[model samples]
Target: MYGTALPTRPALHAEWIKIRSLRGTVGALTAILVATAGIQALSAAAGTVEDGSLGEDPLFAAFFGINFGQIAAIAFGASAFAAEFHNGGLRVSLTSVPNRTRFYLSKMAVVAALALAVGLAAGLASFTAGQALGGASAPGWDTPGAGRAVVGSGLYLMVMALFAAGLTAVLRSGTLVLGLLIPLILIVSFVIGGLVGGPAQYLPDRAGQMVLRSVEHGALGPWTGLGVSALWALAALAAGWLAVRHRDA
Candidate 1:
């Protein structure tokens, strides 16, 4: 009575449904908004460039909350894929679609779309809150690099999330990816980044964050840096696909 099943639309829809229904996903999205905007607000209330403590670029300070918000973004992406490996969920999903490639793509598409949407919202919120709290010292919306910073903040978050998602797929454990990724981003990228100059700037988090800066000091420009992060995400996703295709479900 039923026809041959199609995987594209239905798989996408199923993936969306699964993502939306997850409490962790919802919480992660909320955390992104709260962390990004809250930290920016705190920074703005602290002082401005005039104080000689915040930094020269007010726009850079305006979006500073992204440093923490990106963690929530990573969590959201990692957990989404990790859920599949739980309780034989992938087996059930495969039974329905019977196409690993389609299923994986559908899930990733849903993840990417959702992350981008939430990321943009978080960026807008952070900018508005930060600038408002920054008062006269803050850069206006029409300032030379303000628009780019805001947009780049969103794109950076999305890309970082995707990078985490791809790595989670490869590792098959959100905990593993989070454990490794959090330390890499926090310690290695932020701390060692300053000490080890040159090539360290090309690290995924460091490269992606180049867009958030008003002043460019690295070899790669804003867009080029983000492109590097995107490439990392793509490479990780490809590796994940290969693992899924060749390994037993």
Candidate 2:
């Protein structure tokens, strides 16, 4: 006894409802906040300026939990879209909306907006908790670049989640996207950035994370690094759109 078909409402509104209805969506968002804030708070307590462990930048240290939080972000994006591909979900969605382009764009927009909202909240919470735990090394709110770093944390998370969603759309499997991305971002990127140095900075997560750093260490500046990550997301979305348009539902 479902009422009207989903397409009768504004496409964006329909997409929002569909995503919000999923239980995983709420779980993922909660994980983003808890992981980012919790881990950073713990890290801030454990690390110190004297040992040079987390580096001297309090802002950088404060945002450190993002390294873990992004895993949740990626899961949110990948699972949200990928779930549609299973059990004839995409087929049912297409039947309602008909226009693949509109459906895809609307879906992506909702995922992006949702991620950005939660990401911002997570960033703010992480920063506040981190500062409180940072003892003497923590920077004040007015510290130069502090605000940018906090905002950047949200932007970075949003782009990373979108990146995962776009990639998931292409693959049509949440598991595949999670398997591929989590390791790439968490392990491979870390190892490569450590050993290879300069070139590794171009990797999507690394590039996006530059904005969270207090100082620019790589070829790409903070904003430029984030731009690189956005470019990666855009490319993945373009590929996903093409796949959804031409392939059987």
Candidate 3:
């Protein structure tokens, strides 16, 4: 066995199978789809104002899912990795590969890939459904640059998911990681935004929305906003890698 090498790609494939098999993933994705569709339907059916303008801005209107979507994305991303740890399954995973980094990366790769897929489908579906619901002749998927929002949203969600996975690794417990991260990502950002006024523009979650919005109005540009969020993910991932490398299973 020493002379033979481990199949890194296959390990990732195996992890992929393991994650989607869980009920939580199905529940999370279902919530995202329903929330997005329902928001679009409401906005669409809402009565329009005069002067040929929607009561809601189409750009922001199309992305109502961004708010709750993040929660579903995080739950889906962390569920697999966190579940294994919660159930003491990490020992089994690490034992199979014995390369700690590989194990973490394998899980990361699988989770990130699924996040990207789910993000794209959900974002696009929300945009399409919302626009159609609005009854104002929204842009089609093939329309130039019309597709970027879905792709960007997907990438953003994937990064955030990986970020969650990293947090789980560092904390080493599902409940603890969720406890610490939920308030920081979900709750506190809102409170800080209210108090800080202008500078709250730079918070990772706030800035990350730039990629999804129809308009960009802030100190941070579209790419810059995505970069800020990426920095958070990278920082968490680095910490996770370090933890996995140095700690015992």
Best by TM-score, which number? 1
Backbone clash pairs for candidate 3 read 44-133, 44-134
After superposition, which runs of candidate 2 have C-alpha atoms over 4 Å from their true positions? Answer: 1-9, 46-51, 193-197
Candidate 1 regions off by >4 Å? 1-7, 48-50, 193-197
TM-score of 2: 0.91
lDDT of each: 0.83, 0.83, 0.70
Candidate 2 lDDT by residue in tens digits, 1-249: 323322334888888888878898778877898999889877777764223565545566678789889999999999889878889799998887888888888888888888898899999999888677776667758777778888888898889889999999899999999999988987887677444237788889988887987766768888998999999999999899899989998
For residues 130-187, write the lDDT of model 3, one tens digit per residue: 6666554554565444567777777877777777788888877656766766777777
| RMSD of each predicted structure | 3.3, 4.2, 3.8
Error of 1 at 127 (Å): 0.8
Question: Which lDDT tens digits does candidate 1 get at residues 1-249?
Answer: 122323378789999999889999878867888899888888787664345555655566677789899999999889989988988788888888777788888888888888888888888998888667777777778777778888888899889888888898899999999999899888886677344238888889888887877777578888898999999999989998787767788
**1 or 2: which has the higher TM-score?**
1
Q: Which ten residues in a row have the lowest lDDT in candidate 3?
A: 47-56
Q: Rank the candidates by TM-score, best first.
A: 1, 2, 3
